[model samples]
Target: MKPKILDRAIVGASLLGILISTYALNVEMAIQAKPEYKAFCDIAEYLSCSKVLSSEFAKGFGLLPNESALKIPNCIYGIIFYCLCIFLSSFDKLNVIRALFGLALCTIPMCLYLAYLLAFVLHDFCVVCVSTYIINGVLTFLIYKKMKVLSAKKTC
Candidate 1:
């Protein structure tokens, strides 16, 4: 496989993830600003971005709660993660590929955990969140495939 092709795939997936995360962050902000705010992502009672975004977990793990001025939305991390992936993809170094692979590998478990929380604990689904998870999965797969190709090339 061509490295350029893999780079494009990674960049494309990262950009899509960024867009989805941005939308989720906006919905989260709206929910915080107005208690009565209903986001379009609130498709149904069981499938509501508002419910998930408003939950305690949405603030993510940090020293300060989301109510604190220093706190940031969890989606902000997604945006940064995807952006970093995109940035890393610009380089053709094996180290860059390894970094991307490591980042993607780390994200898979987090996505799985969040998916479990949505399905069981939260009992609510955020379409935007799910979409981002799917994107992350795809990104990981692409990175793995790219890594395999790079390894093969290095061996040969």
Candidate 2:
């Protein structure tokens, strides 16, 4: 496959994982459910998905926990990231500029949440959740680079 195609495929796969991870997060939220995958939550007494999701940070610093935040779940962000991958792959077709911006826009909270997980709260790490975060971070960078390269090609 072409590099862009390959990148998009990777992003698509990452999104699917993100979707599953989001469901796991939801399960964490709704019950004392255990994550099927290894995670930061499985690490310690304070550092669990159940703890993290229900933490004040997960609750949006105590602002919009129950409403809009729920709609914008982690998996949905994965979907959005995948959509950006699709758009980026077709940059010779869609709004590459807006999509790049949107991808960065969507990731801010994820980066923050992931940051909090790694830095402050979780004494242990969940490998799958970390993988998801790493995927998103990489996708964001790849999409940005892809957009820049495409724009240059168009000008050329």
Candidate 3:
């Protein structure tokens, strides 16, 4: 596909993924605080924010899980994704490479965290957790490809 078309699709998908995962995270948070979203709470049972969100380990690598730190990993990434989507979809679109770089830059840490969770903590994964993983993985690839093309063009 043409790079522009491909990029628009990627940006759109990333925005959707961010929105969905934000909802899932909020659902998980709800499960942590209350029992309201019973169905969502039920599916995210394996995630157990009680364990993942409120534990010493959630802090990660000697870093404490404060508002900014947590926001950096989960919250800001979503906002960045949304803003990137809006920016690209608007008249002055970003180059595919720049978008891809931004995307991978946002998502790689998440991929690391998810992998860590898989390897050490959560023996089994939640459906939402797995979906988030897949979405991040795809975003990483899409951005990587776009960046590669862009860089190649610059060299040529």
lDDT per residue for candidate 2 within 45-154, as digits (tens), equals 54455545544544443346466645444545555566656555555433654466476557767676666665666544544456666766666666566656666666
Tell me which of candidates 2 and 3 scores higher on TM-score: 3
Sort by TM-score, top down from the best:
1, 3, 2
Cand. 1 Cα-lDDT = 0.85
Give candidate 2's TM-score. 0.61
Better of 1 and 3 by lDDT: 1
Write the residue-wise lDDT of candidate 3 on 1-156 in tens digits.
Answer: 456765776777677777765765565466567754363434355654333433333333225445544533343445566566545544322374575467556666766776686557665455554555676677666666656656666677
Off by over 4 Å in 3: 32-37, 44-62, 65-76, 85-106, 151-156
Quantify how close model 1 is to the true structure by its C-alpha RMSD in Å.
Answer: 2.2
Instruction: State the weakest 10-residue window (summed lDDT) of model 2.
Output: 54-63
Tell me the alpha-carbon RMSD of every candidate.
2.2, 4.5, 4.3
Off by over 4 Å in 1: 61-71
Better of 1 and 2 by TM-score: 1
TM-score of each: 0.90, 0.61, 0.63
Report every candidate's CA lDDT.
0.85, 0.56, 0.56
